[model samples]
Target: MLAAAVAFLFLMQSAPAALRSATAEPRVVTPRGDLAADERATIELFRNARDSVVFITTRQRVADFWTRNVYTVPRGGGSGFVWDEAGHIVTNFHVIEGASEATIQLADGRQASARLVGVSPQHDLAVLRIGGAGFAIPRRVPIGTSRDLQVGQNVFAIGNPFGLDWTLTKGIVSALDRSLPNESGPDIRHLIQTDAAINPGNSGGPLLDSAGRLIGVNTAIYSPSGASAGIGFAVPVDTVMRVVPQLIATGRYARPALGIDSDDEINDSLKRTFGVDGVFVLRVEPGSGAERAGLKAAARTVRGVVPGDVVVALAGKPVSRFGDLQARLDDYRIGEAVELTLLRAGERRKITVALGAGTE
Candidate 1:
């Protein structure tokens, strides 16, 4: 009993010490005077860019069958940035697609009704205008050219991802000249690939450089889970600068057109059969630039369709496929004249065609 009592007392005495050591307070270090230079720069960049970024919400009109009443239903939400001091907002075309109405929410929580100004489905870009007595235009982002952008350079993306407003993500430019497919037209070329965490709601936000200049517009991401997987593509600002002005002025982007239709599958099959290496012109629209330039289209005969003028090159650039021709045309203006090298029958012919505006 004496030994048991002594042991119990010894255990009781050591328990408090063990508890004190286990629950000891962690050492707190005093914070420095301010953030580091790079940290300060990043914070300032976000502060300046946030005001330019806006949240976009859209709605669709739905009619009830029983009551015959029309109601507005919430469609979706995305992000955009101010294009200019005139209250022009730029966003992805897919965001406003099929939306009957849209609203723009500024960083200050001010909301206004937005009207669709124009859309370029080929580039997946759209412009919206907000104007009223209470509508106050936010600061516009400083535009930067993507032509001089270097891979691995630091970039910042400010957007509303998953409805989270004004979220900023930092990353580096992963690549340049990346291409993404467009549903309405040819591929969107010269995309800026980055590691920025761009999500669905970030579709139309500006991708800024280290200097807080708009370098690109965040568009899509390559992810299996429908979230950011470190691979995001942005439409380069050079293309944006070229298209937005035209859109704002004319309410549409007039792509230089050849007015010829070529089936890719058929063209590929014909190329393989003939052992040729050019885009086969399947059909030419009457009164088109192609038709006026004396370009002939493939004709259906007794055995099979006979191949017509195969587009070999454009403006001294070799066109291996239909997309190549479209991409080449993107570089030229609608009224510009281009030389098309064609392979017809057994000879190569050069023809000049003044480009015409393409219809969406």
Candidate 2:
């Protein structure tokens, strides 16, 4: 009886301490201060630009032969931004390349149908207009010139990366004047390169300067694994500013053209055979500016095939390759006169040709 009484007394002494230990709370550490100055600026930039950035989804019509029915299937999607108070949205051309329809999701989670306004495939940019009523259009993005942008300057990208809406990435301009080929048009030139973590769904989004002004349109990235590899290219805003107006007006951007078709392979062969470096004028389109300027085409004579006028320069800019000619002509506008230096036989001649609109 005496031992039982001592055991009960020990249990009574330890029971309260055991219960206290079982219900104890853990301590947690958290950030306690406000953001830094630059951090706050970045946050504010995203806040101002979020409404302008938008999410795009595309649909294509697929026909079922056996059922004799047509269905609209989900195709692909990317990003875009508000271009004006008129409700125009700007995005990459490839985003809606073959789509029959598109849907736009706004920052406020409202959805609307979008119609293709115009597209400049050469620059890989497209404009869309939102349809339906009662939906408020977001504020347009502030435009900035790429000509004054310098390497190492801070840049930002806002897009729906992987369908995650309103994501913002920050980085610096890595380079300028980068070139990339378009699938359906002329090579895209004068591109702005950055390392802003642009990914597949980031295409057609806006690349902004530190002031939250749109500097470029994010289009392509350099990656072997089909993901961003730190090198991403955007169509410069100067080109966008020039092309978008034309698209909005005419539903197409007419590139300035000389209207001469040159064979790059033949030009290379001619360079080796004739010991000259110039684009070989294989054929000149009839009624074109080149033909009007008396640009001759390669002809087959009785003795042998003879080379025609090889374009050597355009307005004092050396035209060593066929792409160089296109790049130089792009700097001009339709009906603008540009001096062309050509080599015929062994003599060089200068002629002025009025630029024409490219059929592309």
- Using TM-score as the measure, the top candidate is 1
Instruction: Report per-prediction Cα RMSD to one decimal.
Output: 4.3, 6.5
lDDT leader: 1
The pairs that clash in candidate 1 are: none
* Tens digits of lDDT, candidate 1, 1-360: 999999998888788664555566879998789789999999999998999999999999999999999999999989999999788999999999999999999999899999999999888899999976756688899999899999999999999999988999999999999987654567788899999899989999999999999999999999999999999999999999999998899999988889888866677899898889998999898888998999998889999988999999998788766765776688888878899999999599899998888865
- Tens-digit lDDT track of model 2 for 241-298: 9999988888998899998887666678889988999988988999999999999998
**Model 2: lDDT of residue 310:** 91
C-alpha TM-score for every candidate: 0.89, 0.88
lDDT of 2 at 178: 86
Please report how far candidate 2 places residue 147 from its true position, in Å: 1.4
Compared with the true structure, the alpha-carbon lDDT of candidate 1 equals 0.90
Instruction: Give the Cα lDDT of each candidate.
Output: 0.90, 0.89
- Where model 2 places Cα greater than 4 Å from the true spot, the runs are 1-25, 28-31, 265-276, 300-305
